[model samples]
Target chain A: MLNTHGLDVSAAIKTLVLILDLVGTFVFALSGALAGAKHRLDFFGIMVLSFAAGNFGGITRDLLIGAVPPAAITDWRYLAVSILAGVLTFFWHPAIERLRSAVLVFDAAGLALFAVAGTQKALAFGLNPAMAALLGMLTGIGGGMMRDVLLTEIPAVLRAEIYALAALAGATVVVIGQLLLLPSAIMAIIGAVLCFAIRMLAIRRSWNLPAPPD
Target chain B: MLNTHGLDVSAAIKTLVLILDLVGTFVFALSGALAGAKHRLDFFGIMVLSFAAGNFGGITRDLLIGAVPPAAITDWRYLAVSILAGVLTFFWHPAIERLRSAVLVFDAAGLALFAVAGTQKALAFGLNPAMAALLGMLTGIGGGMMRDVLLTEIPAVLRAEIYALAALAGATVVVIGQLLLLPSAIMAIIGAVLCFAIRMLAIRRSWNLPAPPD
Candidate 1:
């Protein structure tokens, strides 16, 4: 009976993770679609960017952990979310553009969720704590990196400020929580909140990492 | 005795594949280092580019097929080869640039090897023929695409000549050979030769896929 209860808890956590993942996918897809519009890409190009940005992070993480036929490819919900974001942006880009600050907030949320979820997954897959944290950071930044790459730009994570670090900090918290035997759901929520707060602060303050002298 | 012989043959094929994969990595690394040199990146930047261009394709393939801790990450040989190419380019870039045509030929060979090898691996992993062929082409082109993306440029395969198509054609030949139950080594050689020839011809003739209208 105790084992069954534990299994039930695990199942509930999995369901929560799935829902958050989809939400992350949707927000990232919106960012990708907006980038495509900025680049003057056609409908097909917008769709491609949307899909890539929405799913590439999770797909990459899953692949790294030996998850074959990644959920991004096998799950119809991911596709639907990505396509919906693309279509919405394609037709209502002006309205979406007006909401750029809101988009940034949502993007921060996506990053936070992905970072914590990726750390948890990597930990579950038996990666070392350090590697799990790195994978978490990669998950947070991977989608935006792919989006920038496709647009023929240096990845913002490499050139921009405080983004990957925030993700890493959040992921590190999850790893530490795991080490301390905390409830995973609570840790995930705490990690996401930390990451989101950091990102929001960075944006508001226009904080940046130092660059090399010219 | 016959079953033992079959095992010996399989082992031999695996060894050959490993050798070819390393060779491909070296040549692609050289291309990457050269591109970094062209861009005037610092030594560390050049090394990073070399490693990325040498291994990203294989890494991506391995991940997609659930090969964890990808060969590029786990095997020391891949690292040695990439580092060697980077150091060579860092010092002898002028001489290497003078031998640009030779480099192009080597790159073509690398492409051929990766295309055939990737297809064979995908087949061994039980992917359907069409998806296997596509994965093969991705393995052939993925490195170059990563290199270009990091440099903030459009990938040559998408913009310039008949690169990816040749890879696809070679991969398709390998798939067809598998269907026909041809000797694996012989089929690999034939596919590589066909791919090499097509790439060489395209280079000589300046063949290109059609472009969209302005």
Candidate 2:
């Protein structure tokens, strides 16, 4: 439980959430850098890719909700984090090549964490349940979408298994929990884990929604 | 100059606005395409760059104002325009290379038109005047900033010229016009041209804001 906007919560839990968010940003940024390296992007292009992947979803979400100028712009710390991540990846990426799947796993964890955070924020902002779910999905996937667009490739989200759908599920649970009078702490934990579990299961089982009739 | 929501205005001026907007899109897309060619980017990268240059600002504005999914997502026409512009540039850039300055003029005109239109839309949505003005500025410069970032460069907005300031002026006039009971037609025309003139003057005179003392 972190004190967010004056809410009382366990310090450990709250700190964990913050950690996950930072880690998510780090992993996503790393993924972008790896992609840039693959494309032989210049140093500037690598940094740009990392920054966009780390920040685009959050920026898009905040603006859509009228959080004008967005946290990304207002909080220099976040920008610093992205810049640091970009620089770190630029220096250490040769060592990363030994484990090709590592970046993928990091990105997967980011996907789950971001999905929960985005969904909860949307619900808190007074959006309808379905729209909240949609927003969560959008936020979870938007960073990758922006990255792909910038890199001039189709976004992996358009082809991935249940990635956004997992976010939608977590958002739906939050809405349901609210209606059922579940404790906020319990709801948050359950929702976050549900997002992670669903995503993990999808990956392990190679699960994906069947293609619609063409 | 055109009717929006419940507001009615002159149709002739609306046509002019549309034409100006398209011309702006053409030049903006050209800038994006040129960047792609500089990098020897693939076809996908070229299209993506063109799309970002032409659409990012408008998309940002719309989403911030609660226009969900934004026109850039729901409308195919915008995508079509970007693709067409990119294809044309790819095929005929050699001829256009002689008219680089002229393209800047067109881009400046676009900045003005988009600024006014963004402000007008914000007002229609009942946002505060200051916020409306900010949104207008964002709309005018957002796409180019995005394009630059994608190409891994500093945003032009931070460099020089009255781009965002011009948008702010145009939007401010719309706000004042509404208060003064001025005609919408006159307000839009004057506002847009004021934006264009301010930008052109800045360009011609090499006007710039001083950087903060380092």
Candidate 3:
């Protein structure tokens, strides 16, 4: 087991998480970069938005949990993935926009990955399980929140169908599995798949959290 | 000199900074709560916006510099100030809305305080002078940005006359003073005053950063 902050994570599991993280970052970056394009923001603004959407969630999570110099900032690989996504979107947006369904699918996948990753990290930091799960949800939604805010749109997590709830559900699973002493790898996979399924179902069925009564 | 994270600050100075920070938090919270009221958000939403506007900037800055569990979350005093401001605005919004000019002035003060405080904290953390100054600007404008985004309005910092520029100016002064070995107390005062003066003047004269050609 590869001991990252004392988590008994296997090398293979680490690789899986890393790959998922990179894919998630790329998809989110694409979303943000595309939004910037639609707004006709300049190149620098687009790049900034791309990075914010791709990494801001993890950065927020890390900061709250005391992970100094967040991996998104310190790791060149993460930066590279965001940059690549942004550049690709900038140059080929017309084509990418045609794949809106694909984007939605990718977004669900990203949300699931981020949720579990956030939960694991919070657990590693010894946060209470409830708080850990909340942090996990924040990790999934934070970057998208940043992106929408920059674009002057209501945050999807706050307005969209079952978004933050799905992340919360996934994070809850991770925390519960940890408490029950389940294998970390199995728990993580289950959490991600469950989150993805919830999100996809919400999208398909148009499910939404009820708004407060006036 | 009172040693906080190895920085030499006097008790009097610490008290002053704390007072200013709380005042800033209160003012920003008021602004946020007012926005929430205007938007007809529910009580929960108003409270959330109030806290976000009051504390998110400092939270963002502290996270960037690796301050764990940002004071916004850990410090009960800050939370109390935000809740107080929010509750007041929620109940007495009509009266508060009539004080738009006063709110603007208080916001300027809050911006000034946050800029200098953020700069000082960043420097204490050993960040480079340039980065420190930028972080200061972020601290000044971050909460407002969050508030606006949540409200689906363009960020005032992006559109208002010389807003972020004034913050940058104030932060630069803090950095330069630190490099010159000036007393932290005096330096903070000068930075805040300079920032406030610039912002006030910009508002009065309608000065703004130049926009790129359409």
Candidate 4:
């Protein structure tokens, strides 16, 4: 039985969301392999890094939101796609750098969409605002965090960037809208747009956190 | 508040169990670092792999069972210990390998203890047999599965190993004893010992599943 206390996206919206999710996974996987190539990793290591980066976000989100069995574990399609992406990445890394700027833009778009959608899913399950917001933020930034950790660099979120902050802003908007009894679709659009805008601005401006004094 | 479900461990036994858990984590972390070393990963990568390998199983368990935030995410001490273990492994690969056989034994011991403990926790929370058994199995092998995935290897449990099977056996015993209204501690000890014995036998015989016909 589905929970009745939250908004259910229309078929069209659901289709859009699913498309974005797949796109996010594919790009994230490619990016992961690219990062590994930068470090001169072997093919096996590249695949491992790519797969981990692609799936970690969604896996963490599903477990947190009480989605039993986890979507990644149960759905062979996602696993198939991830494996394919990883394989493709291993063979094609030399050409990826030419599209580095474009790839970052795509990642930014994913962060925006997942933030709002992930939070909405948690809220639908009747979780508290704090938990829902956290899940949303995680869904957006979790993959990148895993990638950075594996790459031995600080997480991009902890560095200077609007990446995670954009997600947080989007999630905050979602939670507040729910509390205010605003329509979910409208709030979703606004929140997503807000995230995209923030992330884009951050990128355009080379925004970064100031280095701390020792 | 802790729910013991009227089953109690003696302070001595409980202390022993905790020590076993730490040993298990250390072994698991070492394995992760070894995987990283095979890939020629950096110190940061080694530490991250170690942390993930050491805690992913219990973290997955707690999250699946609705333990909010999961111990891996919420506990800094666990992260510290796992990373430390990884660093030590990096600096002493030869020494680590010298103790490889002993590590497996400790891991097996942890598997047996944690599997029974997980099942009991689920039963006390009033979950059904199927869910409790699944979770117990997860607690026993989930971390290693995650480690393998991150290292781009097949999960050890899904192979012909006696891993998840032992956990299932333990959980089944617990369920049957509960149905029969048996004493709790007696049943717990029986179930745990049964799992441990089965695992030892499997390792001794080099038992494994046959490869499927292509």
Among all candidates shown, the one with the greatest TM-score: 3
What is the lDDT for B195 in model 4? 87
lDDT of 1 by residue, A87-173 (tens): 899888888989999989988999999999899989999999999999998888898888888988878889887899999989999
For model 2, state the Cα shift of residue B191 in Å. 28
Candidate 3: regions farther than 4 A off = A1-9, A42-45, B1-34, B37-50, B57-66, B74-145, B152-214
In order, the interface RMSDs are: 5.6, 10.5, 4.4, 10.8
Q: Give each model's whole-structure lDDT.
A: 0.86, 0.74, 0.86, 0.74
TM-score of chain A of each: 0.92, 0.86, 0.94, 0.87
**Pairing residues by index, what is the TM-score of model 3?**
0.62
Off by over 4 Å in 1: A1-51, A64-66, A72-145, A154-214, B1-15, B179-183
- For DockQ, candidate 3 versus 4, the one ahead is 3
List RMSD in Å for every model shown: 7.0, 10.1, 7.4, 10.1
Q: Candidate 4 at residue B190, lDDT?
A: 89
Best first by lDDT, ranked: 3, 1, 4, 2
Write one digit per residue (lDDT tens) for candidate 4, span B1-214.
Answer: 2346654446656777666666667767777787777777899888888887778877777765667677667767677778888888789867877888887787777777777777777676566665676567667777777776677655555445677777778877877787789987788788888988888888889865432211
Which candidate achieves the best lDDT against the true structure?
A: 3
Between candidates 1 and 4, name the one with more favorable lDDT: 1
Off by over 4 Å in 4: A1-9, A211-214, B1-214
Per-residue lDDT of model 1, residues B101-161, tens digit only: 9988988999999999889887887777766776788789889888988888766665567
Query: Model 3: what is its DockQ?
Result: 0.19
Give the C-alpha miss distance for residue A162 in model 2, angstroms: 2.8
Which regions of candidate 2 deviate over 4 angstroms?
A1-15, A100-102, B1-95, B99-214
